[model samples]
Target: MTTRMAAPMSVTTESLAPSRSTETACFHCGLPVPPDAPYAVVIDGRRQPMCCHGCEAVAEAIVAAGLTDFYHHRTTLSRRPEDLIPESLRGLELYDRPDLQKSFVRVDGEHTREAALILEGIVCAACVWLNERHVNALPGVLEFRVNYSTHRARLCWDERQI
Candidate 1:
């Protein structure tokens, strides 16, 4: 049986729009606006408070570049600067979940696990060697073997440090 997933809910422009009378947070990232923060960006014919010059610049860039649709359609607000992760790294985070890990990783012992991975973008022997060396250099990795012909790699790692 297939599980049905609900579509992501869209955020309304009104919810993200700044209420000048009582607004105390950055409209772009949802961070608390400092008491004397003078940063703001004009969007949808209204001024929106921003937490910092950084947010103001980014928001202004987005508006100037005609990317305001992101503001209206975002399901969740942006996080604080320190809490934010790079967009490229976010997709790799799914591998950390136990459910996803189960599919590729096999238990070898209490502290050891093995993973069969299919690597992409490999075109030559140097690429395979570079990948093998990089993965094997990790602290808890016990071994890394790769098949250049198939672009497949088997990795053994320690669970506690991995």
Candidate 2:
């Protein structure tokens, strides 16, 4: 039936939209990055692309210099922020006792004693943080610092707290 054949539909090809170029940020300077950048620094513990190794080295130098504000800001943009312990609690005691049944040996004054605690279940920074935090919260603690790499906490405390 060649009577009224419907005209053939013409198919049109749709072009794809261009993708947006990703902007790279420098780890140390917070500057715009290029595609061919080589070295990158850890910005707030996150890796970032850098223009060159010198720039990355400079950034690392800044971090090593104890200027962490920049890194902190950059890290906040992409990662969870860390909770730093209060400076007041940096050097504090948890507990100490001169005559306690189960306690570390003393080498100094009764009020000031050094104890090696066999910390159990300490594996990460969080564990160190928790143990140090709890230990420092004690009334008589004078100083407490944990060596996570060694899984131990070195504590100095006033005997009264025990």
Candidate 3:
């Protein structure tokens, strides 16, 4: 008896995934979202597709911080998730929002603000010192101090300069 073999078939994400329009992009990084892409984050009470786990993590952090406006004010798509940042720096721009500043900043003068901040992941004196030094070096930073025991940071700055 002679046996017949079937032809080889190739499959891509588009083929395996459900159908979607070509215009759909990742809400976080502007990458094209594969039809089958499963990673997503809820933003503004709607599901937003993510390009990868890194983007998803960053989005979740933003949403958790009540900075969903970060999505609204962004001028450019974020960098590739792998290239984003240290956990602490990922959402720096979100702080520009007045709502976020309200949580930590006290108006000390017409142009100055003092922010009481909780420094996360600071486990040692060196970490506190490093943070203090760097923050103090920033332009417009009038003062910066970190308490090793409490990981609380008090920062004074000229809002116009930084």
Candidate 4:
């Protein structure tokens, strides 16, 4: 049987928040934020708009850590969602453990398994792309896809590879 799972997002750095005069991009990932976008948060005394819930969550996580200064100190754009991830998700190795995988994984068929994960800090389309690439690179991973709207990842892998 096929099973479902969660996924992650990506982020970028910028010097300042966009002014209200034009379309505003997400403060963290630079994705265009619609004026009516509901995902937003206050950071460093400024309210910032986010392109998606994942971006908003990442921004809030950063702010909560007293690391709002990261925006100013970032020397390069974050290449993966993992880069912007807070302390809660510092290690990616948890997924490699059988005990942890049991809760998220299910039998898809003979020699196949599926897992779902909710990636809370995704910030952009590139984040999803990077996550898929990263997960698919795993030796057992046969396919990996992340839904940006739900922050969920659906991973299919060879059971024997575990």
Candidate 5:
């Protein structure tokens, strides 16, 4: 089965013409922000195109944390969206914690649980394929799916192997 979600909001433009592809530097990651990108965020008073929602969210978080100086001092393009996720947030094991699981997970059968996640670094169909492949290869993962349009994942797995 396929599911669809609403696209993210975009700032309006005066012209009704289709946007032409142009290579503009991403304000957050310093990579080439394609002309037709669907996600964008305002940073330091200017609106900038973000390659994906992950980049936009990360940029927003950085600016909100008052760490804007990192952009000025950085010498290279930003790391993969997955790598940019802070160490504190990488505790996947936390899902096993009862308190946390109560909020985002649902019990299916005796040994299985289902959950949804918003994945980062998924910018294309290839990314969706790779993520699904890698995650499905895990020991107890019974099902793994990635939605390229929304960058959302649906997963089912055995609690014991998790």
Candidate 6:
């Protein structure tokens, strides 16, 4: 009589292990966050995220002491949502005037022209990235950099195309 060998168990191991945790880094202290350890607060019409209540309180104290730059620098570096601007409804022509002339100073003709734009309502890097992407899509824009602290964007473009 031939003996029947028992079939090997096909048990999957994934069900036995714990589920992966979703964690975000704290904006202020750079700690791993399990929940909403980083609390978002609105200041100067801009939403900012802090690591904890202590950091938030410290931020408030700094603002109360008129140290606005402290907050501005910190908030600018943090990952936050951009303040949406209705570009279609706004007059972009205002930025094209002689006073706001698009010009660049280059020692050699080999260099391209650079222009600085002061964006009024920019709040985060996403806005900067979006604007940069759109502007770069234009025929002549070569490169651009956004300074969140100053809410400004510097663009380099070919003069012939502009």
lDDT value for model 3:
0.77
The ten-residue window of minimal lDDT in model 3 covers 8-17
The candidate maximizing lDDT is 1
Model 3 over residues 1-162: C-alpha lDDT tens digits?
995433323212333233456656777777777677788998877788877776887789888877776676566677774574688777788988999889889999899999898877998888888788867977899999998888888999998998
Please say which candidate is ahead in TM-score: 1 or 4. Answer: 1
Clash numbers, per candidate: 0, 7, 0, 10, 0, 0
The parts of candidate 2 lying over 4 Å away from their true place are: 1-103
Candidate 3 residues lying further than 4 Å off, grouped into runs, are 1-89
Error of 1 at 98 (Å): 1.1
Per-model TM-score on C-alpha atoms: 0.46, 0.35, 0.45, 0.40, 0.45, 0.36
Q: Report the lDDT of model 3 for residue 96.
A: 86
lDDT of each: 0.80, 0.57, 0.77, 0.74, 0.73, 0.56
Model 4 lDDT per residue over 1-162, tens place: 985332222333344443444777787777578778998888656677778776776778777776666766666544437566888767777777878878989988999988887888899999999788867877899999999999998989897985
Q: Candidate 5's residue-wise lDDT over 1-162, tens digit each?
A: 995433334422213223444556565655666678887777556686777776887788777776665554555567767886789889877677989988888999898999988888877898888678868978899999988888889999998998
Worst 10-residue lDDT window for candidate 1 reads 5-14
Q: Sort by lDDT, best first: what order?
A: 1, 3, 4, 5, 2, 6
Model 1, span 69-145: residue lDDT tens: 77866876776665677788668978988899999999998889999999888999998887788679778999998
Between candidates 1 and 2, the TM-score winner: 1
Q: Write the per-residue lDDT of candidate 6 for residues 1-162, one digit (tens) a residue.
A: 995533322322123222444544443434444464556545454554555765465556655565545433442333322224466746766765655563533322554676766778898889988777767877877877788889977878776777
Tally clashing residue pairs in candidate 5. 0
Q: Is candidate 3 or candidate 6 better by TM-score?
A: 3
